[model samples]
Target: MNSEIIITKDFIEIGKLIKKIGLITTGGAIKVFLKNNIVKINNVTPQGRSTKVYPDDIIWINDDVYVVKREK
Candidate 1:
């Protein structure tokens, strides 16, 4: 399966993306992911409050693939 984010605006924040995409229950979850230190942004565990997520980026937590895109 592939998820697409049609550039509706300039850029989307990772925390916002998680909520917008329904990956987490609340914005607090974004903190949990950060506190636990298990979320990777663009293939590396990110530790920033304002991490910008652009197009064609991967957001993975643990072994589950939260965000991904595949070419058909």
Candidate 2:
């Protein structure tokens, strides 16, 4: 099953989402993680850490899948 990440705002940065999900602890780590791992947003590789992710977007990091959902 895919994991869900709840967002309160209209969008969240790819780097922030990585950090929020506990994949990395520091902002700089996002760079390293992105470099070593492939992350796909909506089945497309993100431009970078600043890539905007909105609600209902599907994020894939390696074999793990994450679905973005708006907070109710």
Highest lDDT scorer:
2
The residue pairs found clashing in candidate 2 are none
Write down the lDDT of every candidate, Cα atoms only.
Answer: 0.66, 0.95
Once fitted onto the true fold, the runs of candidate 1 whose alpha carbons sit more than 4 angstroms away are: 1-7, 66-72
Query: Residue-wise lDDT of candidate 2 within 5-71, one digit each (tens)?
Result: 9999999999999999999999889988998998999999988899999999999999999999999
After superposition, the stretches of candidate 2 with alpha carbons farther than 4 Å from their true spots are none
Model 1 scores a C-alpha lDDT of 0.66
TM-score of each: 0.63, 0.96
Superposed by TM-score, candidate 1 places the C-alpha of residue 35 at a distance from the truth, in angstroms, of: 2.1
